[model samples]
Target: MTRRRPPVTPDQIIAHRRAHVISQAAKVGVSAACRAAGVSRTAYYRWVKAAARYGSAALVPKRRRPPVMPTAMSAQEVSAILAVAVAHPTLGARQLLRHLAKHDVHRSASGVQKVLVRHQLGRRAQRLAALASLTAADTGQLTDAAMAGPFGFCQAASVAGQNVSMDTFYVGKLKGVGTIWQFTAVDVATRWAIVALIVGDKTAAGAARFLDHVRAEFGRLGVPVTGVLTDNGPEFVGRDFTSHLGDLGIAHHRIPPRSPNHNAVCERFQGTLLHEFYRPFFYRARIDRIADLQTGLAAAITDYNHHRPNNGAYMAGRTPRQLLNEKRPAQSAA
Candidate 1:
């Protein structure tokens, strides 16, 4: 076995080196001693002067102090901002400034945000995490909602196929094919995604047809979609789409007006699809027909579901297909 050595502190090393230099200077001269010690003559003289003026302890090196910023918030101000932010984790910086004013802690929204950034609480998700930790400490239990994603909207699907979030994305118009729209559906629990590219306008009839495709695809896998979540777009609220969902016995859920975060699962998936597949693929691949784009999209979605690792609340670090397989048996039992 290798013998363990005791740790040496920086101050100890500095003191030892300085004592060697002093002994060398007493034997030889200051110039020669500084050359042997590999230290500047000015530094050696400055150390000697400090030791003589103060005590021998002054010769030992001290850790440099952190520079204080003139515009930095005081401890009390930081505490006040954190308290208000934790109390209302959903509030934006401007809204938080109003609450801070009531407590006699005056600060601009940007200043408060700077303080939050300094303390690693800049994002609302991080603040919500801090609030969850406080609640857990006080109650010894944390709810599922508290552990959910940034908006807590994805928590609506507690099990696989419980809820499916659907949305429409506008892919750039093709020269020959005209306008193109991507109909995207993601399982809120497993994040299993299906996408279809339409060559024309995204009408109610088209959306309803996409819903049929989604149900049929999941049905083939022995998973029944229980609820459909969508934004308040005309395509979703129209009679054709509503009547289709009603006939299929699937409950239709609409997000609040102008609140896209309530449908964040679909929103984030669309962003990923755009960045990972569409952007790069369109940049290189020539699109002569809508059929070619649809085929490419289907292949990308397959890779996403089967191979790509997802870091979602439900997926952890597994692929959507793996998560779906793990949850399908339990869902059938329920």
Candidate 2:
């Protein structure tokens, strides 16, 4: 035998009907609102029974239970972890674990990974695929020009006693008002460099001034410049540059156009200058004062030639100055 459900009163039926009408009008619908209100149609009917037995208080809902505690890490700890990750984004989980260990945080790599995943901070697996798609493919073989030569072509051909290569770099932005150019000359075999900062357009006059500086250095060393090899820039090929070289009785050879490899010695030294001195000096002390910058450049060049090792030559154990001094005996012998 089955028990029968209690009868619903008129007041409860009216309240439930009113709720259903309002819910459907609000777009929540009767079914959704009942679910949200934690009441079934049967329960609504039971409330009607209560209303029949009692009054309007039967329509009221029961109190809801409190929410459960979250398993997520604290905000402070997450902030610290994020700060560390940002400072060294390239660090792997093992490295990160080691770094954290030093700071007294003992957590497994897998545990850290779980935390990262929970916070939506895990490295994307598709990032590597995207990187691969973006990278350029390595083409075929290198030509003779592209290949690194034995002792490099510049060093191999340039006898320590003779050849020099000259080049120029713009030191200032030409905002129409003015500009400065740095003209540099490097002894191909010895790695000795003479740099000059000239305030003006990179004209023939600027090149001539640089030549004069090189001439003065040659006088001190008591060595005559036999040949000067330079790129086919306007300043080097101009009448003033040619006439000055002619007066000094130095043979000038213009490198084949677009072939910097022929003058690789000077190019390599320029890279060293930019890396070891120019970049650091410019960063620490802004080159706003031209005179100070020039003085600093000169000192840098002196230090480079006298102290820096020359690894390109047979005299690898010696500095540029020491190699040049050694070259004097070889030149005298010749």
Candidate 3:
């Protein structure tokens, strides 16, 4: 009858390894130790290799096959994506691909994201680095490295009544609906946000009305906004919008020409809306009217403020509603 080699438990193998190594240390060599332990020199050496590589956990069985399957993206493509990602950490993959396309380099968004994630250079990492730099500058560091990005290192609201930004954007060209305008407001401190659909052409009156809506919505949630920031677009600079802010006793600040970084939080939120809400909500479903789109926007924003993680510097990993609840006294004061 053929005898099977008895199963060697990880603990037994580990004990055997200690004996073998001890023998080697005593100038007895691994061979004598292997013989005494009923293990071959090959098994002894394999154990030695594994122990060196993985420490105590090496006694457990490991895969003999290849560790990781190769990715679909080529090494060259991944390198390019990573290089650009480190250079422009704020940009999304789709935007990154566009920048690469000019140089005849191409990569899918997921593949590019994989490269960024692998290197720990994802957007969140970038945000943290930027925030650190900003804090340093705020404490009078004044070095170029401290004041690098245009965002000026957007930190969360130190006080509950810090800056909030508002903006209007053109969503897309729907078949029968023409262009849909989306008005967005985001609290820089708390990452609390709200969205509303605008009908007809965008005007100063519409902008002002949207500001009022934002105030009421934020107020109801106990997050009274103190200051509002907007771009230098005609709708925002016109009398209607400024007058509306003056009436509300809210300070209004306008960004400089071609400087979106001044309003980076609002712009980033717009990108979030496009990626998380608009693309999936519109492209995947059947919608016939603007009213349907409106409902969809409302639903999306509801999920955003309550369920989604903001990942903002100020948020430090909390949903808007959670942050509000945690700071109820401060919000109530506002």
- The numbered model that scores best in TM-score is 1
Provide the TM-score for each candidate, comma-separated: 0.56, 0.50, 0.53
CA lDDT of each prediction against the hidden true structure: 0.83, 0.66, 0.71
Best by lDDT: 1
lDDT tens digits by residue: candidate 1, 239-274? 999998899899777777888887888999999999
Off by over 4 Å in 3: 1-156, 326-334
Q: Which stretches of model 2 miss by more than 4 angstroms?
A: 1-161, 174-178, 313-315, 329-334
Looking at candidate 2, the ten consecutive residues that score lowest on lDDT are 133-142
Write down the lDDT that model 2 would get: 0.66
- Candidate 3 or 2, higher lDDT: 3
Candidate 3, which ten residues in sequence have the lowest lDDT sum?
140-149
Per residue, candidate 2 scores C-alpha lDDT tens digits across 43-96 of 545755676676656555545788765645566656655445544556655667
lDDT value, candidate 1, whole model = 0.83
> Cα RMSD (Å) between model 1 and the true structure?
11.4
Error of 1 at 254 (Å): 1.1
Error of 1 at 217 (Å): 0.3
- Tens digits of per-residue lDDT, candidate 3, 125-211, equal 564455456555355233333233335443234444456778887887777767778888887656678787766678899988888
